[model samples]
Target: MQSSCRKTIAELGPPKHPVVSARSAGRTRDRSPSPMRGYLIPSPLPTRRTRTFSATVRASEGPIYKGVCKCFCRSKGHGFISPADGGPDIFVHISDIEGEYVPVAGDEVTYKVCTIPPKNEKLQAVEVVITHLAPGTKHETWSGHVISS
Candidate 1:
């Protein structure tokens, strides 16, 4: 009876589970539950598109008036040149400048004029590339290759 059972089992071949094969190879068994019952489906998120512009750096006199850059918004015929920085002034927006990266404080940038006087204070940056980056004041040193022990 046992011999017949053994022959029947051999004829049936392997089981349809990865764990069974892994155990036959002297490996530890994994018993984690799977998410095949519609429990772990992932969903996509929404995204937004941003517009770009350009400008040029302009000089100013006030304490916060480090300088200004000119940028255009719609047409070239009309545009406004606003102060880039004013001491204690806090009305600068990221959309006002045009460039691959945002301009850091003390960075020299050029942009296009977007709004002119008697109309609006905002300027649409057509091109906003940094002309001069503030120099690094700190110094660093690195040691040469280490000797084998």
Candidate 2:
């Protein structure tokens, strides 16, 4: 299992050339035009990758909550939580979410999100994968594990 810090660094490659700051009181004069650099260094920006996942919809239950226009907000630190009919929050990747059909708030939409878990680490909601459209009905009910008091 890779730590978050390690993963971040690995994703972001090492810097290319060392940057030198100009001295304050250095008298400099240039007559000839500066030569164009031969090779261009690659950017260090991290590559954007989309992952897919599935979860149910719930308000303030788990982490993610559906927002206006198919967009979802993360709960705590996890990614977006997709809503389903009476089920766990469906995790979906932000990339997998289609921008064409904007999902309205409270609309049951399907999407895909990323999921990463380390061995021995407790599983947590990371992203949401909108799969199927939940049936439209007022006052929906769900069943959960019964806990004996």
Candidate 3:
């Protein structure tokens, strides 16, 4: 019976339409005539080359400004800092952060400023150091262990 079933299944060929990956699928969701045809979708996350270039151009020797962590998404690899001087929140990349622990909301941090590329009108935080962890909140280390501070 098993041999007959195997012989019957062997007659069938491969699938007609092959699976198309998100990268290979150039059409938009609507599938309308798009000007971006054949162009690869840009990732929201920053690439390693971008991090290296920005780091080399912006040194860590500048005056450090005190700030509190507004919000940080470790998975997203970016965050915003509320400056102690009371201005717009500055963008901080994961590569810019120092220390073993990942930053959480309300954590006290000191960081240097760097102009965002292309326009240079916006500022971002670089060389970030977490001075104080937020009380009563759980903190996670880069090694994936959780600690209460």
TM-score of each: 0.26, 0.26, 0.65
15-112: candidate 3 lDDT, tens digit per residue = 44578788858764543333222222122333334755645555555687999998887865777889999997787788878899999999999988
Model 3 bad stretches (over 4 Å): 1-58
lDDT of 2 by residue, 66-97 (tens): 32122332221113243443444443333334
What lDDT does model 3 reach? 0.73
| Best of the two (2, 3) by TM-score | 3
Error of 2 at 41 (Å): 34
Q: Model 1: runs farther than 4 Å from truth?
A: 1-92, 96-99, 116-126, 137-149
The Cα error of candidate 2 at residue 88, in Å, is: 2.1
* Tens digits of per-residue lDDT for model 1, 1-149: 13243233234444667455544776656644321221111111100122212112331111222333232212112222344554222223344444343343444555443332233343333334456543542211112232221
Which numbered prediction scores highest in TM-score against the true structure? 3
TM for candidate 3 is 0.65
**Residue 84 in candidate 1 has what lDDT?**
58
Whole-model lDDT values for every prediction = 0.32, 0.31, 0.73
